[model samples]
Target: MNFKSLKTLAVNGKQVIVRVDFNVPIKDGRVIDPSRIQAALPTINFLCEQKCRIILLTHLGKPKATHDPACSLQPVFEYLAAILPGVKFAPIVPGTAEAITRSQEVRPGDILLFDNLRFHTGESENDLDFAKNLAALGEIYINEAFSVCHRKAASVSTLPTLLPSAAGFQLQKEVEFLQKIMEKPQRPFIGIIGGAKISTKLPVIRALLEKVDYLLLGGALANTILKAQGIAVGKSLIEESMVSEVKDLNLVTNKLRVPIDVVMAPSVEPDALSQTVAVANVPDEQRILDIGPETLELYKMILQTAKTVVWNGPMGYFELPQFEQGTKQLAEIIAGLNAETVAGGGETLEAINQLKLNDKFTFLSTGGGAMLAFLEGKPLPGLEPLTIE
Candidate 1:
């Protein structure tokens, strides 16, 4: 995973295109969360220090290869402009004459943020022409978007090949930290995996089992494992298709820990009558929503002894107040531990952000799918061109 480093690159007074992940949550024409934008500041600021004319490229939401105003990066630009100096906006279509003109107009030590890259049809298609056109705007390409590094898109995979490419500071740091966890983690390494789908997390689960000393499960992912062992999950959500796959994993082991009790209710409504019950006592019509207090205590005991902890996803449907206790409590327990803690994924970070415990962890990765893929021992497409062959 060796790659060219941006800090060592010679980019004085040159136009540098940086692919950043500004895919933040926008609400009512405003950027709701700016963590992703803030994460790229170190790289952007470093380029500014090097007197580089920076052209920023990012996709806001899924535009689906159309010109959708709702998926525009205008809100992110506005947010960035207020906090950063010498920042300008290029609201024209990417890879067009207007875009080239705007990019050329960028002065040294200034940033010119382009409109949504996903607005163009070729960005997601990994089209060479689109990448070549994008490469024309700058002499160097820096990928600061680790969150989208797993994607094989034109901007991420193809554009890097068209220019002198390097890994940005954020991307470099992400790879280093994740690589440490995978290759040389401290003894007593613990992994906590949760979320709604077993299909998405199965590979990482299997990969972690080979490395981690203990693997704890929660959320709907645990329900499937419980069901595969002939345990009744009531009306809980479980992937029926993955049951056979789960059974093949040999769940009757000591390393993997499933929930012993859960918080269940007839419905997921906030006011729904919820009760904590042992795994074997769930009613036929009740749905499991969160891990119970007993299960939390068990997880806490295991976490207290961890020398290193890697967590992805939440312990429950943390969006709801009643079901948020398990995730919140676990986060607090981990925060108080004397361990090298790392957590990632969209929902996991959201829960951490809501808990205001970001500073407590050793590292909070901006990547979700990329983090999982790296942990699963898979090669990332966006990182391929930057690799120092």
Candidate 2:
């Protein structure tokens, strides 16, 4: 918690390099969701008011150090121009002479949008010389990409040390919310966790066991848990390897809540077939794609009186229309609940949007990996540099 606030520093006429997470979903060369961009605006607007020459740095989809035109941030610049009127933005790819020249063109109140930093391998590698080259572009570094803070990328972890660094408003807010849920959430606190694998969410599940009154499992993660408990989950996605680990948790504590029934199908196609059945009755060749009505009602009942709730991952194979019911129903439940509910992760965000329930929650996070890391008390390489300690 020792990180300096963006407000504590003088930004007047100084060049400020803001590392923002603009890895938004795009389709046909257009940004489909502008929420991530909108999240960074408060920090950007504050910098604008301070009359600082701004340089916006971010990565799109991973290119793994290879330059791919498909992963360009050009659409983002276009989206920004539409939102922030009167702001001049010059787009340039960093690690080039042209980028340096473009940086010179940025005046007070103007921004230089650096293209996908992943185009150069140094970004992912956290190369020192690359960090120095990036630091040369500005006098101050503001780590605004809380979504990517768990990584040790050049701009995220390295540049912060090479320049005067601080957390942006979005990062600060994310940290506060993480603390709110993990450190001081009100009871009866409940957590609804889902997704494709138990391996990824194991630490988070273990962490929640200590704090939440009930830790509900769903999706493939639930299937694995069921398998551990010696339940027959037929043709469902279950991690046979993680079953032993899940089994071991039985000895640790008793917060793990499980589903009683699930929606099943022989094939997960759009219109093949589906049926809601008890967990003990899953057919041999059928897959458990969604939670059954009984399980859905069970969740609603538990969430009805929750004083605080944190949910990550979708409740089922929410991408397929046939299996989206559980996740959507959970979203609706969280939306209507009179509780301090915080929901996040990529699939969970998609579920919230698909159900059009964004504003209904108390907080929506931009970070996925970073959120889990913070909740599990793991070291976040990017945020560590800014920590006052």
Error of 1 at 132 (Å): 1.4
Q: Tell me each candidate's TM-score.
A: 0.96, 0.95
Tell me the whole-model lDDT of each prediction, alpha carbons only.
0.90, 0.86
The per-prediction tally of clashing pairs is: 0, 2
lDDT of 2 by residue, 1-389 (tens): 66799988887789999999999999998998888899999999999888898998999998744668788888888999898754555455675667777777778878778888988888888999888888888899999999999898988998999998899998899898878778888989998888888998899888878778988889888898888877788889988899888886663454677778998898778786888999989878988888888988988888897999989888888778888999998999999989998987888897898778999999999988788878778989998998987
Worst 10 residues of 1 by lDDT: 245-254
Off by over 4 Å in 2: 86-92, 251-254
lDDT by residue for model 1 (1-389), tens: 78899977898888999999999988899987788899999999988988999999998888855678898888988999899999988887778778887777778878998899989888888889898899889999999999998999999999998888899998999999999888999979999999999999999999999999999999999999899899999999999999988997665777899899999999888798889999889989999999999999999999999999999988888888889998888889998999999999878888888889999999999999999999999999998888888
> Measured by TM-score, how close is model 1 to the native structure?
0.96
How much lDDT does candidate 1 score? 0.90
Candidate that scores best on lDDT: 1
Query: Model 1, residue 227: displacement in angstroms?
Result: 1.6
Output the lDDT of residue 306, model 1: 95
Residue pairs with backbone atoms closer than 3 Å in model 1 (clashes): none
